[model samples]
Target: VSRGQAGKPPGGPVPSCPPSGTKLFTSTVHCTAVLEGFERLRQDGLLCDVSLLPGDGEESFPVHRAMMASSSDYFKAMFTGGMKEQDLTQIKLHGVSGMGLRQIIDFVYTAKLSLSMESLHETLEAASFLQVLPVLDFCTEFLISETTLENCVEVGRIANTYHLAAVDRFVDGFILRNFGALSQTAGFLRLPAERLERALASDSLKRCTELQLFRATCRWLRHSGSRMRQAARLMSRIRFPLMSPQELLHEVQTKTFPRFSPGCHNLAFWRASNYQMLPPMQPVLQSERTRIRSDATHLLALGGVLRQQLLVSKELRLYDERTRLWRCLAPMEAPRYQHGIAVVGNFLFVVGGQSNYDTKGKTAVDTVFRYDPRYNRWAQVAPLNEKRTFFHLSALNGRLYAVGGRNAAGELATVECYDPSSNEWTYVARMAEPHYGHAGTVYGNLMYISGGITHDTFQKELLCYDPESDRWTQRAPMSTVRGLHCMCTVRDRLYVIGGNHFRGASDYADVLSCEFYSPAADNWTSAAPMLRGQSDVGVAVFQ
Candidate 1:
């Protein structure tokens, strides 16, 4: 017999068997040749047992039942589920176009899909109906990767309809992360009611004032061919209570189409009236120096007791070091005195204080609030576990520590720490003893608490609490005896601002003197004094 007929090579050389190490490479070559032969059988329509008649097309694709059934659940069920289609040579697919069917069938045989934006939707729909999970997965992944804020709404709708739960969630998250940008896009203007509801309910939405949200919603409704009938229903999702009344009246009432209902108007009016009834916003007290260095330093003064006006101040103010100008900030919601304020990163946290608005300073409140100067807005956060006032508030390692504040029971030596990440407060090690009005400041890694009033006695004892060690060590006493004063760290040095100092028996005064303690020298030296004497002052350092 000829060599070809004998299944032998037609080459000139007849060599001996190769080394055993080359057996794996020889097996791989044989496997590839077998796959190529199968591909040839498919292309030439050899041993074909089935035909797929794509919708409304004259051409029918001839395929093998085993190949089709192996790649698609629909074909497998037809051939094995005792269906009448099992006996037929041709199966007609309805609702799917000829091109979409071709794409799915090609992927089934080749395990590949070339998708484009133009044909992606139709192909996915066909794959979904045909139960070709691989192609459907490919299409969904492609759409998700290409999804932008401009097309996320539509993509999300499709994903939801196709029951692609994972893709749907991804689209929703993408929409929320880019909500600010998407809100102004055409996709947002045409968003369906269900998707809009999902977005409105998300607390993780980008932080924007209610006024901005209102304006953006109005813009969307006013867009061409928008369904204005849904305006009131959509606008209701907005937290109207969180907005200032002036914002509601002007931006929402005057500008929004289809005027708000009488109930909404009444709600806005009530909130506005309440805001106006509260104490006026306080402006920053400018420094005596007209011009200062080009430093970005700023000082924020929060709530305190104004003895002269008998006012429990909830006002907030910011003094710019570079410009030497003071500007007004949004006031705290609760009129407070003897509150604790500290800066942790960009946020200013206002902690426990006495609510002196009605009783003129009787009850201490446990409410805590956070201020974002970037937006000039304040929002209430998790309250303290213990209601306290005259406490020392300091931010260390991105946490707020409240130490030695008096509750209804009297002065407290208890210590509580706040973590912004969890938005909760936990009690830590107690102080050596209960002391109130004792100033606390964080310098380097340790928290230092110095002079304050405890049991009607002015203290001069200085103590340092190490967070890492969770222990307190006594430090040298301050030369001056003071209480209700403010302490801050500037340039790595400890500073004591104006405080109530006892001049003699039963004689108290607010001292204008300021002093800095150098850790290296272990001594105190006088720094520039304030323009005036002030006590219960809230000090904030912004660098």
Candidate 2:
């Protein structure tokens, strides 16, 4: 109907319609302009006002209110939130040192910091007071990474003061692992009376014999001459009954026998005269003895569901490295599918999992039990605080960590830890998000959780938890979204085994594909595929 418009196009000789192509346009941007501008302002001392007085000495530095507020929560509140320092041109910091303030100012301007071990304590103190979390985190992580038995006690004290759970855990692990050499350490000998008693009580303290433990305790008491009153209390923690009759007489009955509690004397005498083992006098290194003497090059595929049938698998098969063939071992106490099984020392622990058989309305259970392969028996241990299914089960620093899973209220992010020494489950830090059907494995001190289901959808998340820092950090995602997978560590490398793979449109048959992750490289590589597609399967490493 618009005849005039149609005729205009013909008159322009088809007006050379522009070639079908996109116009290219770009404007140059200075990548570092903002940072450079800030640097210039700092060098020129432009518009700078307000002087900060250090805690000690006569040094004072002029700083910009806006810059200080932007960088620190403490300064932001003081300057912009109408604190007393808002109108005051000069403010005194009661705790920060002049050198520490300089470092903090440099970091605020340049987003860079040079921290030395000598200056770390002062810097961290100032940063914590100023609510500068970045520098505080940096200092904490550095200290955690550098922790050793030599400084573990000192680090423990510092970590306790700061409420740094991760560092505290690292210190505890260090003490337990190196307890054999504890007496030789001046730090252990000099530990405050309260700290020494607590450290000695840990079941994880690794000593070969009760005699050695007694000697170490005596040495610590003698070194701290003021702790004579604590001798009986400290000696009670030592397992006198674990000593052989000869050792009981020669080690304790001969030396500091009078220092021990009267109850300890009766117990030591019973062991030395009678050959009966007492419950309280059990060897602290009993687990170690079994681990050292046993050959553990056998991989066991525990109970799991097979074609809708719960393999309360009585006939357990293990891959024997020497025979290169699967060998049947003793079965579990009952059929368990979707359960967590991990080897801690000489015992294999079966943790929480589904307990019901109904495919429609199965329930999660908190039953925990341990199996000693040498004895071919299963015994119930402590139960979890919460019943969980599809949770992450990992052993780190000689303790078991159970992360997020499905509970009575549906998905949960709660985390729990099991200390074999205490034989009790305790709550630890919760995960950032609820993870069900996730694959978790430990490499060194860190636990890695890959793709999993959260809130009914498959997730591409990859998270690493640092037990020493009690913190979690997101990592590069998995190549494919998956859940209900099996993960195992072999030679420090992590391998994600068969699991249900989500292809966006729908879930594919449990994938036979596997992927290998290198923690050092922070990357994943293709691995040999499994013989069959599998989901919710158990994996074990034989070495």
Candidate 3:
């Protein structure tokens, strides 16, 4: 590992596979040994060919030409091309700090980097100048994982400067999730008009009403003369039809705003005012601007037991963060529990689970329902090939995946996938062992299932499913064996919340402890435990 690297390398036998000509081989000892030797040689100033200087009045590093050229495109171009520094023994790098350059050189030989928020900017500058893609990619990933409301705009600026395209997903999602708060940030006023408009157009930008969104847009326009030019473009993204008529009349119509070509601004206000005043003509007058922005999150208490009696609930309720209250929404046509819910695009998908029961004892249904929050309605879609309960449903790459869960028959190992485009379910590879009472979520385009029941025992095993290969591979397990837990991804970290763990034959206890998994380090670390022990509980990220 490189100096100051925070994580420990995964411990295991390093496997090496040789082509058809080889008989046998040992742990890829040669690769590590050779790299270590090179590192030692560099440290000892042996076989040094070039001296690379970073910035001005800083220490210079003596390194091999082949090593520098192979690892960095900037060095390759400088030393291999007809540049003036090609034949020179020493090269000076501008705008790259001594520490940053040293870190980059160390990574060239060690394949490890120490990236922290404090040093990330300088390292990104060095990597950008040196054209070290892996380092830039690492920085981008780190930015995506570490970004919060406070520094998200700074991260966005860094990404734009360095061309770290990968952080866009995290940034976009963060802005949508924190639109209400982010709009008040100083950096929000600096956001490009197109980006803000695109975000406003999404149905998932919630937690703020159309009035607040309009007020925020007005403030952005008032920030500078340049922003005033884009008022029409951005204000058009606000759904005036969703705003209250009183707000339209008092807040919008009364404000003396900037003028537009041929008085377009006044017309925009007038049109919005008309949208609210005319109810009968709303259908034909409806546009993207007329559509209400759907809330990105919904924590509903679905069918669950209250006491001794089984309470099968179809009532869909929503919890309001601002008022600290709950409200009812459109309920499901059919009542069920143990089902899996996932959101893909603008629609919410409900997968297989247990339905109403008779004297037969247990019942699991294969029914799949699609909920469109845009209209607050539910429509039955394609059913799963297998009727599974206690399963996990995850949306990956625009497809829904139903993982291991059981029915009245028995626990199942089979897995199936649903493609919304075709409205069909198809079987995928089965799990190594069937599991239930598990929790699963998607992170980095991969599906992770963890903490389930297998063979009548708690399963701490974590399994990762790759859609491209249609296979399930084992990952590091949780510290405590648990089931009936909640798993979710915060930023890029995988979190396992409250669950149940068994001590003995009849000693079952609710797990108050929680832990998170790092797919990069292939390790688990304890997180803040739940306030109270819970099982079969729901978990959703607030922001």
Candidate 4:
């Protein structure tokens, strides 16, 4: 430490400290002063030598080389690196708009931007070209929020052109969700066959019926004479077997299928024949064309109460197990918390949960909404026979079982099963005791419900339901009594992780301890405790 301020920083003063101690301090006010002073100099063309000219020659701006180089990597490389323009007082720039350059230069000086929806894309172009990271991030975030069906095609194309992988992936989702609508638009015809093929291959392609999807493929191919060369590749992605016999007949009636080669005409015959023979054999006799878009699954986070129960959230997120990344999906149509989710075939079902935002008084729902990830569409399904919250909805044997949970009336002991085949709920043998907040999963032929709360009392009993026998047999009990924890099975063992055990009246403590159930041994064993204790946690299996 210099005693008399000989080593003082260029920007400002430091707060006084003990004579023996050295202290480092930062001055935001001084930082702001430096940028403001440079901006004034640039505006007045003072201390400025470089004059930048855009390729269009619409306008030119005089600026300081050091100022421009400091904020932009592109300018830095051009002005300071081995580029020929490094020592040049005047430089020519291309592929950026005059207005965009003007805006970015101002933002660089003032640390403020006047961004608008109309100017956003143009600004994004300049930012990408200039390698101005901050403005680029701002533009990306803006597009993420403002992108819609009307503009998604343009946004997606631009993202693809720029090779912005994250932005491209997100915008691609928007494009797929509205592919049906876009297919009717001129933009659909303008899309390259390679891009069209990617969309058609995705199970996430939503909203378009099979017939519409088939027409979309043919439409893009017909738009350009050169496109016919890629017809087979584009057409192969359509799930022909998913079309109804009536729809297939309509395709024949429409006569829209074109034959580039002699063999192209058999598409209809093979489609019809495969449709008739394979309708019932579906899923079992799967091929690229016969396979439904949705058979693939990913980890999903459904709506729940958020922000200390002050708000009910409709946000839906997908966690890519492979990439280990979380991305937003179309949210549920309505808000729900304390809801139960189950998967049946290519669909995900959200059963009863509370709707009221107020924690003091929560309202339960009996409504059911099924989500099709292929199209990112949500449709109402049969409502549960009984409304429930903090319940267990488990899928087994092509059916959904909604186990006991709470309602406005209180904890429920009744149970019901929903058959997607029939779209109706039927009474299932009830648990001997009513409990809410229990975690349930299916292992083999039976559904296992473990650890729940009955009123204020936490439950430890593990009950296994045999659908064939219509009975729940008591299995080994958990080592700890807790509810609101999550349970999952791996390699035939049930892992119960983090919930809360009751302490005393209206008081509970987080259960850091975890346990697993071994069906082979019919007993429980302790597992390593979590570093941090949590309640009402969610667990999922990646494989």
Root-mean-square deviation of every model:
15.2, 19.9, 19.0, 13.0
Candidates' TM-scores?
A: 0.51, 0.48, 0.51, 0.53
Which candidate gets the maximum lDDT versus the true structure? 3
- Residue pairs with colliding backbones in model 4 are 203-374, 204-374, 206-375
For candidate 4, lDDT tens digit of each residue in 1-543? Answer: 445557776557877875686779998699899999998898888999888887677477899888889999999988878888977887877878887888788888988877777897678878889988888777777777877767777777777776667778887777787787788888777776667778889877866777888887877777788877787676667776677667666673346664742345476457656745632223234466654665356789978667764788888899886688999998898998888887766567888888766332247889988886655778787799988888888989878899998887888889999876567888889988888988988899889999898866899999999999999899989989989899988988999999998788778889999999998899999999989987775788877
Which parts of model 4 have CA positions greater than 4 angstroms off? 1-25, 58-60, 82-84, 94-100, 114-126, 142-150, 252-254, 258-272, 278-280, 287-488, 491-543
Better of 3 and 4 by lDDT: 3
Query: Among all windows of ten consecutive residues in candidate 4, which has the lowest summed lDDT?
Result: 278-287
Clash count (model 2, backbone only): 3
Local accuracy by lDDT, each model: 0.74, 0.74, 0.81, 0.79
Instruction: Report the poorest 10 consecutive residues by lDDT, candidate 3.
Output: 1-10
lDDT of 4 at 19: 69
- Alpha carbon lDDT at 14, candidate 2: 47
lDDT of 1 by residue, 1-543 (tens): 456635557765567886775333346576556556656787998988988887768678888898788888888998999999999998898867788888987776666789988998779778888889988889878988889877888888788888888789898788767877888777787777667766665655555555666677667766754456666566666655455557656665566533534445555445444533331111111111111112244687777667787778888888876678887789889887777877775567888888674322247789988886545888777899988888888889878899987877788889998877567799888888788887888888889998887777888778888888888888777777888788888986899888886788878888777787776677788888879888866665665
Q: On residues 1-543, what C-alpha lDDT tens digit does candidate 2 reach at each position? A: 434565475344445675697888754655356656776787787777888888976687777888888889999999988788899988999899988888888888777888877887778778988988888778778878888778777787878777677777777777767777766877887566666666666656654456677788888777755777788777766665445567777777776766644655666466444422422112123432223223245677777666655434545677877778987778877667667777676467888887555322147889887876644667788899998888888878777899888866688788888887667899877878788888899888899988878877887678998888888898877777788888888996888888886665764667777888888888888888889887876677655
In candidate 3, stretches whose alpha carbon ends up further than 4 angstroms from where it belongs are: 1-22, 81-84, 256-262, 295-543
